[model samples]
Target: MLSRVAPWLASRNENGLGVRVLGGADTLALRALANEDAVANVFILAHLESTGTAAPTSGGASVFGVFDGDTLLGACWAGANLVPVQLEPGLAGYVANAAHQTGRRYASIFGPAETVLALYSRFEQLGHLAHEVRADQPLLSISGGPAIGANPDLSFGSMADFDRILPACAAMFEEEVGYSPFLGGQEFYSKRVAGLIRQGHSLVHIDAQGTVIFKAELGAVTRDVTQVQGVWMNPELRGRGQSAGYMAAVVNLSRTFAPVTSLYVNDYNTKARATYERVGFEQVGTFATVLF
Candidate 1:
């Protein structure tokens, strides 16, 4: 049986390691655990806290844990996306045993620095490929850019717009999230879009042709920060640099509600990454997503 660790953030030693789900009130503590510079849990905790969804299955969900036998080590929860664990040195055996016990197959994994190589080698021994390298680059804005201007027909979308927006929204989800919202359903997708609209964070750009050609939505928002998400341009217009301008415009527009803006991109996506850099986003850190 796995040892149960208390969920209190303040109770952690930064030296004791185990995995347990902290209840709702304990989220702040989880946030504290993430703030530790040495082992900041990024996507795992952010999604857990933001979306309040956590399920551990071979092909879904994400889970995180702290390893405290010596130094406090925080690892990202890739769930069943990759085998065993995303970050490791301590407890690879434990992760493997757990996955085995549950009959799950972890196809591959990713992590930061040498830690990734070590885990990769172990998974290779377990018969999975260390075949690819992936990086989740975190981006934050630094210095100059106008907050708001050139308001190009900005307006909040109503539910009435869903019929028209569904196709593009679903496409954005597939491209950015790596999954289709249909599998998750329309309600979840609609709620997500509505939330952004309510916050005045979803924007669309239409050309003189009256075609809705560009769109971007907020994934996360706070008093000081708004994350650009679901960014897309109609496929027919892919060759043009329309996305970059819309991104800048979104940043400019969102600043009215939030002061700092940030987002993440897959490292292999050099095109989108370059566009973000051109519009003034600086790489602040890295993150990863493990797909089973």
Candidate 2:
């Protein structure tokens, strides 16, 4: 069986549509295909742009590719967060066999549903466990939409707002992922918050006491797409019916940075989905996530 399965072996370049870990020499090929589906590939592209195929010393992350005789066909990035980013399909078996040896066990696997599912199924067939599978997330996008509404209090977050925004960010992460992001350690997460604030990527609405009531971050921006993430509202404020208006405000603010604003949400998130619809986002594709 080992001999028969050798064609898809990873970490080395081989003949035909084989699997191998990518390196600096593969940068141009990887970047071309990653940009071909920029929104879906942003996580990997963001890494590739910074490190350019050089494996980082501390990030505990690596990118792998499936090549058709050295021509790239697909790639996947496994990183410190454990959310393996699926960039293309047609290499499920390759990813399945390569996951553990290429990187540590992950928290989740996410991407376009069809590809994510294909990879997850193959991965699990080899005995990995999935704590949850969000198999039908709607990938939404907006461009040239109707004018967005405004909220007097909703505005971009700054260094001044960092302390106030961090708790809300932690709350949102816990609620969405079933655990506090602070579990690992405060320093890494804290640095992430500060970095986003410094870059003007965070937005929030604060009250008189400087409590953050609404928060979101511009998570990724590339020439082809921009993504919004970490959206949250103070739980006590819910059912007062303010989310729709504030979300629209974000949509308007978002377009200034990129012509297209995109995000993916679990299919069961009816309220969030409705708010996005009201804000002019349309479901352009489906995504899936497997949480471990």
Candidate 3:
């Protein structure tokens, strides 16, 4: 848990209306704020539920909160990526300012479209330029069974499939992010994949030859929602009209962890968007990502 005595990053009036590192005492307030939009805030909420606000994660990640006097209003998870929770566009500047003061370089800033763009604008003014900005990613969710038939072969991944799953995950990451996740070192990325598999979060379909056919992970999970991510299909199978069935399976499997299954996708990816629609997902909100 974060220390209550942790120095304030940005203090305002005596009533404490400013951005600062959240401590264990602020857990309830933070949860209340994040739960306001559970589906959209699942990533941060999952982290909080699993790790608490006691101390930073092994990756030096911490939750930063914005307050209006003593009442908590918004939060951002400062980690590999910046995930804003219930943050208004107007308040993003304050969070961005506080984040910038830490002198940390983030892989990306992502969340509700307005807030993310607002935060990115602040960072831009501070001389931080992005390699790419996905300004309009649709956040889609499904609460009921998928419309398409689920692929029976798709199932939770295990260590026995780790070798195949790891490389496939890396390929998806590189193709999406424009850089290899293994650029820094493969150890960290490998551990993340293994960890997800160990938690039963990795979902995959591997062929007899040990090739990953379809893969996706329940990246963020809470009792109410689970966000699907790292969705991928074998290149040889593209345009074979197979994504819907696989995605239907993802939706079905995801329900074992949470009632709602959710994922966000780039606006330009019309094919993937259509596949999700075919699987019964409905657009719930918009998200944006500014890759650094």
Candidate 4:
């Protein structure tokens, strides 16, 4: 594990700018930096609040920081996916270079549009190409009650609905990522869905025949915001006018955990975008994703 992070530890530029693995002592500074844009940095903030700044002993994930002297300027969550937080566009190349030196293969890189794309550009220069680049995802959020009526049928999922919900989740993942999430094994993905259900993070509207009508998960959450993901409506039900109500219900239900509800949608998803707008969400920023 030390060897995995050694390159970052030893790298420092002439201008006092450097990238290194963050430790527990850096928690306060890191949290402060993430708070600069709570909605955009909610994922890292949630992780920090839950897990602190210590890197995992298994070498699975670690927070890397960019600093000038002792001041924290930006950071990146180097794990299954690289998530940049408050990373300045000009400094992205440094972070990407350090990440490349670690020889870690990330599944994706995602976050604010400018930072993600800048980081991806540096990665591309390092010969780390992406399978796809979604460069214009709108990051939408809502802080008050939704504009439409809530769906009466939508409810938080439970273990009893797991059988139906898991397939819908997998379908959404496959549709979005261009591969089945179950390709490696079902256990990991199954546990993830089950955990979200158990934690009351999974929301769904299952029909009488046990078919999922609509589903979405609060993938990243904090007291201030909940980032929605894996949102899906049954293919058979897509053309109906029910999406707005269902999404309104999602916003209403999600507020129980956090005041602000947020989710990013691909620029090409006009229907979802329209439904979200109808439900009262407004674009706060742009996000980008580089799928590996």
Alpha-carbon local distance difference test for all models? 0.55, 0.74, 0.89, 0.89
- Expressed as tens digits, the lDDT of each residue in 197-270 for candidate 2 is 88777989999988888999988866556788998989889978788788777777776776778889988999
The Cα error of candidate 1 at residue 143, in Å, is: 5.3
- In the range 49-109, model 1's lDDT, one tens digit per residue, is 5565444434354454445653334444545353222344444433433334445566445
lDDT of 2 at 127: 75
Cα misplacement distance, residue 37 of candidate 4 (Å)? 0.4
Where model 1 places Cα greater than 4 Å from the true spot, the runs are: 1-16, 36-63, 67-133, 136-151, 154-156, 175-180, 183-201, 206-210
Worst 10 residues of 1 by lDDT: 1-10
Scored against the true structure, residue 243 in model 1 reaches a CA lDDT of 62
Expressed as tens digits, the lDDT of each residue in 1-292 for candidate 4 is: 1112223223457768988988888889999999999999999988876776645536568888998999999999898899999998677777898789989999999999888888888787678888999989999999989998999899999999899999999999998999999987899899999999998999999888889999999999899999999999899988988889989999999999999999999999999999999999999999999999
Provide the clashing-pair count of each candidate structure: 6, 0, 5, 0
TM-score of 1: 0.63
Considering summed lDDT, which 10 consecutive residues are worst modelled in model 4?
1-10
Q: Which stretches of candidate 2 lie over 4 Å from their true place?
A: 1-15, 50-58, 81-89, 145-147
Candidate 3 structure quality by residue, lDDT tens digits, 1-292: 1111122334343556788888889888888898899999998788777977634667678888888878888889898889998987767878888899999999999889988888888888788899999989999999978998999999999998899999999999999999999996899999999999999999999989888899999999998999999999999999999999999999999888888999999999999999999999999999999999
As a TM-score, model 3 comes out at: 0.93
RMSD of each: 7.7, 4.2, 5.4, 4.8
Q: Each prediction's TM-score against the native? A: 0.63, 0.87, 0.93, 0.94
Relative to the unseen true structure, what is the Cα RMSD of model 4?
Answer: 4.8
